[model samples]
Target chain A: MKRARIRWHILVFLTPAVLVYTAVMMFPLFNTLRLALYTRIDQERVFVGLDNFRTLFFDPIWADQFWNALGNNFWFFVIHMLVQNPIGIALAALLSHPRLRFAVLYRSAIFIPTILSFVIVGFAWKLILSPIWGIAPDMLDWIGLKSLYAPWLGKEEYALTTLALVSVWQFVGIPMMLIYAALITIPDEILEAGEVDGITGLSAFWKIKLPLILPSIGIISILTFVGNFNAFDLIYAAQGALAGPDYSTDILGTFMYRTFFGFQLQLGDPHMGSAIASGMFIVILIGVCIYLFGIQTRMRRYQM
Target chain B: MNKARANPYNTAAMHGALILYTLIALFPVFVIIINSFKDRRSIFREPLALPNSESFSLIGYETVFTQGDFFLYFQNSMIVTVASLFFVLLFGAMAAFALAEYRFKGNLLMGLYLALGIMIPIRIGTVAILDMMVATGLVNTLWALILVYTAQGLPLAIFILSEFMRQVSDDLKNAARIDGLSEYAIFLKLVLPLVRPAMATVAVFNMIPIWNDLWFPLILAPAEETKTLTLGSQVFIGQFVTDWNAVLSALSMAILPVLTLYVIFSRQLIRGITSGAVK
Candidate 1:
């Protein structure tokens, strides 16, 4: 009886969180994959096996959008990897320097945008870049570069890239903070030894600090990958679910949303939407699996 | 250390790079807040300049309040965020305690299962979540949002709280046990207090995402009564796209509360991250 009573405490403590998470999170995730395998016929869900998958892949209508969104998503991830991570690393390196004046102030300032809602960041950037307002143009004109100013958000050629950069601007602080934490964790004795060996400044960063923080960087990269692929709020906020200017910025998240919820002309298709979501799940799963099996193992070995 | 102080040229260059990056970081926010306070003409005419008495006006704010139910939206946001944070912290702490303090069956499996949500976003489950909400008649209700967000926040909260909970002193717990305190009492009185800072850190980490989330609010509960500040602002700005005054004002309204919270809690937030709590 006492053993049973003691066990009840664990159950009492664990039940609420586990129940809620399973009901709302895990069950739904699996259910979505199940839903993807079935399609509606005369308002009833009928198991269609891989029919939906075939339609999604071979049907030009769906294939074009799927591939386009997938490609755009890749580009978005690439931009963050290339631009945001490097910039974040540089800022973190600089800020982590011992005796840097006003480090806290700079960190707070740089991180402010990260805390702002996607709605605010999106609209603020949209307005600033609007050609009619001439704010971006005027700022450019000050440096005699007004000719370079264009309605980047309104053009198919530049909309996705433009939005990607905006997202990078907002979220660079995360990598900076994470990498900063990693940098500070390095022992002072090791750095002192490096200094004794004449490794300081830029070379010191490349030779010593960079290698030690590789695990953190790997984590950040996976985070960036998951975040970019899962991204929708920024695009939806900035350009609507259509991800407009000819749907140049539509990624998997937006595509899934539009498919599930339906936009102006499109009817909501739960089955197909689930398929796209499952597609996204697979893509993310592949990325994560690769990281887990490939990158994480190698990184652990190097760290050891 | 000597290398840093010995070179004035290097110091100047470092300062210059930092200042340049800082400007790039802050310029947009500065432009938005400053322009939100200016009259329509000056907002466009002098977007770069700070408002003087000649150009300053509350017309934009007046329009925002009159046209939108911003106060109600703020209240909704407050309720949802606070309620979600409470549940996340409480439930997360309990679960963390169970995992960290006990040698239980399926503990590792459960931990892995919960941590999966951290990597695989809850957004992917929207189709079924919405379907379930609709089936249960929870769609278009704030409860839908609150529930989903609680679920969304639990994984990270559990992970971080458990890490902190593991560090709690076994000696103190044993002493409490010997003093005839119940396990529940020990957790509430001792372990809970010990992990308070971590709980604060978890709350801070989760707060911004919950408060600033546009997707779930848009998907789950976009009804007027259920609209959060982020969604309300998004919808309002979308409608008033051409109305620069209203648009800018609405955007500022969204920014101010979050910025205020961030400024207030930034020390805890920064310390929480830099203290290796997350790592």
Candidate 2:
């Protein structure tokens, strides 16, 4: 009877949040996914089953832009995975070093960017990279690499990669923090045990610390995957809604924004925007599911 | 001492890497900040130099104050951020209490439902959300930003708070129940105070992103009257790209408050993260 009463209390307590969140977040996400299935014709919304998906896939106009944005989004995720996680891991390893002085200062300095508005970072980088201002060129000249300087944010080739690197700079602190926490969790006795076995410094980290933190690394990888795919603000701030010079920096988030809202000569198409959002949702879901089921289970077994 | 000093190789490498990465992390801000105190010509002539009598000028500050309404934008951002944080915390805590303390049929399902917001991007529903906002005539208002941000923040707030609350000892609530404390009384008197740490963590998590975001401000509230510091600075810098001093100062203006707050709370923020509050 007492257990039953507690369950009742739990239900009453959980209802409001769950209800509101479901109505607002999950419902809309899935609704967007459902809305993607149907197409609108002459102002009437119709259930065309997979026609929108087909159009997103096979239609000439969208197929080009859609695949381009999708490919950019994938590359964007790849850059984060390749750059952010490794830097985060390296920082975390350095931070976890017992001999380091002012570890707190280093951690905070590294994390300062993550705390600022992306608008600030994006715009600041844009200003710093502006050719007219010549800060980048001047800085490069000081290092005797003046020829290497270009307005990377303005260039068609370098814009997306530049933005991705900026994002990595901002968010790498997260994985660092997570991995640091995981490092702190391992028993001191294990490290002592390793030392006793003549594995004192670098080998101690490589053998003991790295294995213990694999789970945290896996978690950070998935978080980066989801975040990079949904990213919009920095690109929007740096490149605007056109995501140009000729849509060079277009990622899924900006693509969805441009499609849904319409800019310049393009008409706003809610159905198509929903279609793109649904595509992002599907991609994110696939990444998340794979991480949770595949990587996590394997990591857990390794952890034990 | 002899052994340790003999093996300077690894220690030197470790310190070398840390110093290099720290410089990489800090140099951009350092360069901008130090140069902001210099004259326009001095800014470019010796961008790397610390400002002395030869480099110092207040022209940027003069231009920023005379040519811009920075204070107004800062005020707007503060209002939107604080208001959103307030709603997200109060209602989020309330809903978290409901989930943690109750046992309805769909209780587990409901908790999962709330937590799902963390996984999905709220930007997916931009079309409907904007349509609804306009239909209600909230476009260009700070209230529109608040409502949208609150909706965006509440899910993760509830999820984190609920996890913290469940760890609150069952004995506390059971004792309150036996003593005839009402559910609301138990929550207000017993629960709210205990969860202050969690509340702080949630506030910190939501505050930075909401303050920094450009998408919502750009889409829903782009008017001069409603511009946040971020949108304001982006425009300011874009227009004044040639004015190095003004651009750097404008960037400084955006960085100062958050940098101040971050330095003060970084220890607690680190504690909050390593404590698994965010997870």
Candidate 3:
């Protein structure tokens, strides 16, 4: 057999991306995980061996904030999964209707928010929902539903949900577009087949189309899961790093931010921040693993 | 299709629902843009109304221009985003070409290693990244933002690009090889052009996030000189929160560029998404 020549060009092609990604992303991530197992004591870095994790999970003060943020993060994810995905799927279905008018205009318009920066979306909603100058109250009044209006972003009970909904408003286009893509790809023959079987219109969708798009939905669900757990910019932009209304809107991202770079009177603790990041990594990993091992394996991906 | 045509009432409801959601999506943005042009008082009084001659004022924009380094912030954002996009596309394409064209040992492992960052966010490593930045003196520089964004963008770019690259006709590349065209030549001259649409998809996907990212800019490069448009608007808006005119104008200013670009590229972007580039 002839000796195979070493493809130096392949290495040359791959080196830049690999080097940059490793140095900037992978190395930092592993270092962060390592940092989580260490702590600074008296200005000296010392290995604490999961003490930070213990503090984050078991210590009363740290545990309270940690759990609150985790719970809020889950709620954020839930809102997205429950409200955003369904609405997105519905809008996509509506848009995909063969006779739907102005479908292009509607999709483009609805997707406008998705392209805007979170700073823009966050502050835009903050103003629109402001108690004083906000038009939410006025709009409600015009509709004779003034009693339904409140400073939703200011009230503790409503803050996180309001932010989550705002986030949904910005990102619903994602699922919609993804699902829409999946919908349009469904062969006409299949729908015609469904119609022949008396599964037309809404019934057709519920029975035939929905099953085929379950894989797309699964992908969207996992994307939403990852996005929601890592969400920070909206809350930070709207409510500041405090994630206020007494931290009702805080999530793992903000919690990590605050701990990594202390806010107000609290001193920054990198160790605890890494610990939080690790916790988030675990949560996200668990979610992804469940999807991969538990859910994805069971879903049937239709070839068509 | 016939069922949809037969149900006129259903069609009406579908249009109605779509129109309603469309309004809901565009309303806040519309209000902000209009209000930004009006005097602060009109902004409060007729927040929903269009700007009339009597209500029109440029003071908000004037305030925004004078109070912050809006131009500098814009320049910084442009530099970072464009530079990051350039590196991401180039490096990502090169890497994708290798994986697609060359059958090598550990290729699967290499693919998986590169793809790891797709599901796991780059933000989790901010602690050590910041530390490394500080150590290397890249903190508070555009370089820091660019490097971070390049890393952030590469995984998805490589993944998408490789998928497209695989579909490029092997016959063309083999013929080119027979012609004594170097591998690099084939990649640069042939493969890159073939994958332009996917490159656009990757670019569009990464562009918005990089331009709009507030976290890394806030943490890694929060200095006055290195402030991105997103961070600048954020800090500017935070300070001028009580000033509705300035805030609205600042926001509108922040929004106008992105909105304009989006309008221009909206078709391409939507097409990119629905084209299954991501799937």
Candidate 4:
């Protein structure tokens, strides 16, 4: 009887969370994956195994859009990996300096943008970059670079890159804070030891601090990959559901949203939407598996 | 280690770099908020300048208040955010306590299953989620948003809270056990107080995304009464795309509450991150 009471208590504690989570998150995720394997025909939901996948790959109309969005998504991830992470590291390094004045002020100021919604970030950037307003142009003119100004967000050549840079501007704080946290955890004795051996200032950071924080950098990179791949709100808010300027800014997130919901003319197709979602799931799964098995395992051995 | 070796020139350069980036981070927000107070012509002509008596106008605010149901949107957002956060904390804490305090069967597996949500984006299940919501008659209801946000917020909350719970000094728990305190009481009266700071950290972490989320709100609850400030502003701005004043005002209205809350809680927020709570 006493053991039964203890077991009941445990169940009581776990039940609400488990039930809610299972019903809302886990079940829906798996169901969506299952839905990917089936299609509908003439008002009847039919189980078609991998036919949708084949259509997505071989069907020219679907293939073109999928490949385009996938390519753009990869480019988005690349910009974040290349530009966002390095700048984040540089800022974190600079801010983590021992004698830096107003460090907290700088950290807070830099992080303020991160908490704002993508709607705000997207619209704010849209207005600033609008050539009609001349804010960006006028500012550039002050630096004798007025000729450099163009309607970047409207042009097919620069639209995605512009949006990516704006995203970087908004989110650079996350990696900075994460890396700063890791940088501060390095033991002072390690830095002192390096100092005693003629490592100081720049070399102290390069030779001592950077290596210790590599694991944190790895974690941040994986996070960036996951976040970049799943990103939708910014593009949707800035360029609308069409990811406009002829879909130059379309990524997997927007593509899936459009396919799932159906834009003005296109009919909503859940089966194809699920297929695209499943494709995203596979790509993300591959990226995560590579990180876990490939990067983290090697980093673990190096840590000791 | 002397003051001279600190390199005054290097310090100046570092400050310059930080100051420049800080401007880049804050300047856009600054421009929007200031321009919201200006008349249309001035908004374009003196976009970079601060508002003066001649330039200042309440027309934008008047338009936002008149043309949009901002108050209802704000209340809707508040209800959804607060309700979801309450459940996320209560349920997340209970689950975290159970996972941390017990060594029962499937403990590790359960933990790993919960942790999977951390890496995977919940948005991938949009199609099924919408279908389930529609089937359950939850579509276009705040409950749909509340339920979804709770699920979205729980995994991270449990992960962080459980990690903190494991450090709650076994001696205290043991003494409470010896004192004839029931397990639930021990959790409520003792453990809850102990992990309150971690809970606060979790709350802050969960609160921003829940409040700012546009995807779920746009998908699950786009009804007039159910519109969140984020979605409402998105639609409002999209409709009034040519109205510079209303657009800037709408953007500023969205920016203010979040920015104000951020400023108030920024100390705790930064402490949470820098204290290695996140890492």
lDDT (Cα, tens digit) per residue for candidate 1, span B42-155:
987888899999999989899999999999899999999999999999999999999999988899999998899988999889999999999999998888989999999999
Candidate order, DockQ descending? 3, 1, 4, 2
Per-residue lDDT of candidate 4, residues B34-115 (tens digit): 9999999899888988999999997988999999999999999999999999999999999999999988999999999888
Candidate 1 Cα misplacement greater than 4 A, ranges: A300-304, B3-5
Off by over 4 Å in 2: A1-20, A37-49, A301-304, B1-9
lDDT of 3 by residue, B126-243 (tens): 9999999999999999999999999999999999999999999999999998999999999999999999999998998998999999999999999999999999999999998899
Q: What is the C-alpha lDDT of each candidate?
A: 0.92, 0.82, 0.94, 0.92
Q: How high is the TM-score of chain A in each model?
A: 0.97, 0.94, 0.97, 0.97
Candidate 4's displacement at residue A117, Å, is 0.6
Choose 2 or 3, whichever is better by TM-score.
3
- In order of appearance, the predictions have TM-scores of 0.98, 0.92, 0.98, 0.98
Candidate 1 chain B worst ten-residue window by lDDT: B1-10
| Candidate 4 C-alpha lDDT tens digits along A171-283 | 99999999999888777777777777888888888878888898899899999999999999999999999998998999999999999889899998998999999999999
Per-model i-RMS: 0.9, 2.4, 0.8, 0.9
List pairs with backbone clashes in candidate 3: none
Worst 10 residues of 2 chain B by lDDT: B1-10
Ten residues in sequence with the least summed lDDT for candidate 4 chain A: A1-10
Candidate 2 per-residue lDDT over residues A29-138, each given as its tens digit: 66777777777798898888888878888999888888889999999999998999988888888788765677887888888888877777787777678786677898
Query: Can you give the lDDT of residue A113 in candidate 1?
Result: 86
